[model samples]
Target chain A: MRFIFKTAYEQDIRLFKHGGQQFWYGLLGVALLAAPWVLDDYFLGQLTFILIYGIVGLGLMLLSGYTGLISLGHAAFLAVGAYTQAILAAKGWPFPFSLTAAALLAAATGIVVGLPALRVKGIYLAIATMAFGFIVEEVLARWEHVTGGNTGIIVGQLQMFGWTADSEESFYYVALVVAALVTLGVLNLLRSPTGRAFVAIRDSEISARSMGIHLARYKTTSFALSAAITGIAGALYAHKLRIITPEQFTILQSIEYLMMIVVGGIGSVHGAFFGAAFLIVLPQIVAMVKDYLPPAIGQATGLQPTIFGLVLVAVILFEPYGIYGRWLKIRTFFQLFPLYRRGLFRRQKAFMKSERLR
Target chain B: MQVLQVVISGISQGLIYGLIALGFVLIYKATETVNFAQGELMMLGAFLGLTAVTFGMPFWAALPLAFAGMWVIGILLERVVLRPILGQPAFTVVMVTIGVGFVARGVVTMIPGWGTDTHALAAPFKGELVRAGGLVVGMEHIVVIAATIALSTALYLFFRFTRVGVAMQAASQNQLAAYYMGIPVRRLNSLIWGISAGVAALAGVLLAPITFVHVNMGFIGLKAFPAAVIGGFGSLPGALVGGVIIGVVESLSGVYLPEGFKDIAAYILVLVVLVVKPTGIFGETASKKV
Candidate 1:
């Protein structure tokens, strides 16, 4: 009995400890793979949502979280992707070809939007990106032909290898596979030299440039990559919903994406997953509990944006590093066991140094 | 004659942008953050002016009071929303101000009597026009120019010799050195915010006649931001020139270019500036410290 107790504790510590924490992570990955089979139809739909948004959030994680280019208009890129796919597919193009076009078109638009980053940083860049968002939205509403205007158009259903990817099960499988592949691709890329360049530019662009990283090119390229990924997610989303409208790509949606990155923990790969899942699930959970709440509060939910504003302010104030970052820290604290490390407070002390960097 | 009329109108409209751009420059200089809520501030000021004038106060009588009220509001906003997030990454402050903007717009829309209808400001100088060589200009244009000049002169005087003004200049240029030199940096920052909001209120008061004091009048601030950027965000004089440039460019675009293009001219100007001369026409390149 004593030996078993000691063995279990050691196993937990070994899996949870230090840099080599991939063992339990591997188990979690296997569980996720098996999840779709056991999930009911409704749960399958929710999982589909998680997978789609997870891809979008992952793209954002790379841009805002890692590269330090805070884009408030990512939804515009998603629209570009969605519209491209929708328009092409509506015109009787193949799904596979439409998907490629969607990503390329979104990437092209991202390059033009990202041109502002060459000259500005931080707030100015944010404003520039926002302006681009507004312009894109205005174009969508007014152009009428390309976007189908405010009336919007339904996207043709996706097909794969003579099989319709229509049912919840098939959609979930497709999204899951795409999400998994993209997640893997991102994971691999982050370990590469290009990812290092992104981090370097983000930490200090001047220093990064000094160290022979081309600031303009890397920044723009990172933006293009982020946009392309988001575009893929958007294209997938259009097929999933069977509707493509300018409303799906509004500035508010862009802000929601930003909230996801912030809440999930900026710059962490795992953070994107948490952020996407939280944003998708939290509102449904709110709606569920909302029935039990008092009448006045329920009525106020009509006036209140509620969880959206509260979560944004709370995360930025209390958990600036985000839930994922905090989770990582707590896990680290236990692994470092009995070390009494307070991660957030230590971050505050280090802030002065960070302040001067900006 | 047609071209002359368009140019005059553009210059007149540009003055509105310049006024708001001045607001952007004023706050940006003192605090390194560009308040995205500046446009909403202008909107609030116009709405407040409407309140003052419509509630039986004369236009001139309400103008100064409105300015004073907004100045106080600016100070309060800085202290409450901005000051706490002062040391965070520029992104956090940006989002916070964005939230503040959202709340202000929501609150404004929530007001029962205020938002449901849009009423023209009972301007003391409504329906009046001036003709210069067949180019028609509204009396509002003359007032805007005269009032803008007067306001600019007063600001110039304040910065040139006044103890507080020069101290603000010192602090904005260098906080640590100003602090070492016995200038209260935080106080100066608050004061600058007050002045920015005050100036914005004055601009709104003048703009009420021309733009008719609607919730949408504040969109002028969006165009003005581009003016500040094109003029160099840090330079006060640059903001003025930038505003004029945007005004002229937009005016020309509306007349000469395809229809509906002028609405997007500000963004085009920003894109051009970002691509061609990002340091702006007047802003000096900031050297990176190792």
Candidate 2:
């Protein structure tokens, strides 16, 4: 019902399919820009965190969703970025320089970790990454001079070119601009040949290899790019939080990113934003519900992760495509309401076991 | 003498790791999906064992009671949670098991006093130390090592000689072929889950004397994962050997290396093994059909 009638290659590859999408996106953009002014300081801070997570989620989506490489140690990369920035910033490096340094350091680490991707994949890759995460955490905790050990580093206000995002309201704008730029950058990359190559690898590495896609080059590049993006997000997060610690970026944090991609929609760029917002907001929603429940149940922090687990299971079971997928279904149903068949959306099979790139 | 003492203690700890890794290998061999909840299952087993003992059940009786209870929980978990998504993607299955772990940990934490606090399991062998020609090891360590040997031998014989065990093996190798041959593959899967959970319970009971009973004991399950990987995810003997290797390495490193090296030694070993031999020590070469 919402078919796009494209007449040219340019039109077919345009970021927006039609004027309607552009309008909606523009309206959303305005709302984000206006958010700090409308919302209180507490909510504004939450928005900053969500944007940071969105950046992290985007990096993961590019690797896991697009490249079909699963990693459970993303938090380790984040730690690398954060520590790099924190250490450099403490030594009086400017904001942009430290941020770039962070991304470079994190990317280098990602490449080393991605070396295992050449030999193993799927669960083995996941285990390797997780092991890497633990190693980074151990190093962070023990290397007291550089990482400040368990005590952590306090990042001062971000300053660049005589401008400072000292206030929550001001910092919101900086995060907003960076997130928008990254999201747009990712969208453009997806339309590029490299993005198509990633999808090809994900769908079937054997087929992709036959089609002349260099597995090592593209795979490592994906890892490096993803790590760089996540590192930038980490650098932003460190500045926003003003204090950073190894404990903050644990394996659990990595899993939370995976949950975001799964719950948002696995293979879509929009899914990254949706997942980040959902996960960031879900805990707040849970905290609000505490008032109605009994004291013990209400106050229990463990309840949050319990609900996250249940949501993840429910999402995978019912809507494997996630909230975005469900939305598409509902929108399609409405568009073709009278002509919709009883089993219009029915498939021959529900779940396909993804083939690993061994 | 110090080295000998460490080796003795390491073997004991390693056996416990092997016990938990056995549970991991069991489920992976049968289902082909790593159950991230294996640790929480071990923790649950420990809690149930503690509860039974607190209710005046003797240590011996409490052990089996806990095993049986865990067996039921395992069966119910497979039936209710896992069965619905049996043929789904392996990633989805893995995630669901992680969810199961989260739920298990959350539910355990909500159980008031039992969930929040750490308590000694008060085993029959508690606090008894054994000395043999200048080597001193706790009686708990001796029991753990002995129990591991007995369990491994029993499992080996069961698989080699028992009809149902063979049936399970047949099912694991190729579920559809076994199914066509009139094997009840689904029921076997449930039994496998039950057995895995029971093994996890055994591990918890054995480990409780050394580490004490606490919700956080489930974290050891994460450590066991490295053991399973080092041993080969699917091989039982590999899991045992891997566990001892990890345990000994950890104990020795804790004494000889820098402060934090011991904590990460298992993971480092896993990374090295993955790089050097992706299939692990006893893992069969998995061929992918194009």
TM-score for each predicted model, relative to the true structure: 0.85, 0.95
Candidate 2 lDDT score at position B54: 91
> For each candidate, C-alpha RMSD in Å?
4.8, 2.2
What tens-digit string does per-residue lDDT give for candidate 1 at A60-93? 9889888999998899999998888888887777
List the pairs of residues colliding in candidate 2. none
Where does candidate 2 stray beyond 4 Å? A339-358, B160-163, B166-178, B287-290
Residue-level lDDT tens digits of model 2 in A1-358: 6778778989978999899899999999999988977999999999898899999999999999899898889998888888888778777788789889999999999999989888888778888999999999999999998889999999888877678878999888988988998899899999999999999988888899899999888999999989988998998988988999989989888888999999998899878888999988998899889789886766665788788888988887777778788777887778898776746655335323323212
True contacts kept of 2: 0.43
Candidate 1 iRMSD, 1 decimal: 4.5
User: Where in model 1 is the C-alpha error above 4 Å?
Assistant: A1-47, A138-145, A250-252, A277-310, A325-358, B115-119, B140-142, B160-163, B209-219, B287-290
Candidate 2 RMSD to the correct structure: 2.2
Provide chain B's TM-score, model 1.
Answer: 0.93
For every candidate, the chain B TM-score is 0.93, 0.96
lDDT minimum window of 10 residues, candidate 2 chain A: A349-358
Q: How close is candidate 1 to the true structure, as a TM-score?
A: 0.85
